[model samples]
Target: MAEEKDAAEALVTDLQKKITDAFDVFDHESNKTVDVREIGTIIRSLGCCPTEGELHEMLAEMEEEEPTGYIRFDKFLPTMTKVLLERRYRPISDDIILRAFEVLDENKKGYLTRDELVKYMTEEGEPFTQEEMEEMISAAVDPDKNIVPYKDYAAMMVIDD
Candidate 1:
């Protein structure tokens, strides 16, 4: 008889693994804690570049203690896992996807302009160069040169892959 793993336990395990991997990749010297600057680089390595202020704020929230500025293995693990689990559990219904598209297409023209992308992603301080935004929209737009539909957006998030 195998015992079922509780949600908290599972989340803790997953978060710890991710934190360990991040530490290994970012900490070339294998120091337990990465310097504040390196934390920004690590977050960028995960694809979204965080501004300095954003990095500081995020780290401040993540760190429970002040001394070493460390996200202790125990403390870091559970938080990350909870976030991932919530994301995984979120029901991306068709209505939700349609609403997201509508939100993104602020002009209601059914297509996302480069300006809109910049404006949207900028809330996170992730400024995309005009060229980058253009490329992203090019890839995201559907055939017939029409804007990406809700179905397409939802398909991008398929968890079972």
Candidate 2:
């Protein structure tokens, strides 16, 4: 158990050093941090391709101590660790589907009624046709409960990429 604990600590320390070194290359201004706008560059430097929306979502996940939208090495470490882990384990579409479910499940009931799903699919941005909406609900909705749990929704939308 002690050996396992020591190994984990060593791994974390090594990752932190690599991350801080990457940040240093871009922290040339001596601010000891990277602005949120440079997030894409930093992510790419770290060998990840993240959309602008994803970058904003990451910043949103940071704690209150990360004010000014500037990310220091300490703040960047945990956030990037989470982001990398999620990307490695989760399908990209899962995040999109989860966000959509959150928007439609306004009551925070953890499930969406058929009507809520329809409303979401028909909304202004990229409106889904009636047929597509019906297909989506039919594929994911629970017949007994008349709702789609977020897990079911994500499963229906996930593409093995």
Compared with the true structure, what per-residue lDDT tens digits does model 2 show for residues 83-128? 6545532446677878877876778899988777777778756676
Q: lDDT of each prediction vs. the true structure?
A: 0.57, 0.71
Best-fitting candidate, scored by TM-score = 1
lDDT of 1 by residue, 22-97 (tens): 7567666665656555665555443333354655666776776665745554454454455455543233455666
Clashes of 1: 0
Q: Where does the lowest 10-residue lDDT sum fall in candidate 1? A: 43-52
lDDT of 1 at 113: 48
Local distance difference test, candidate 1: 0.57
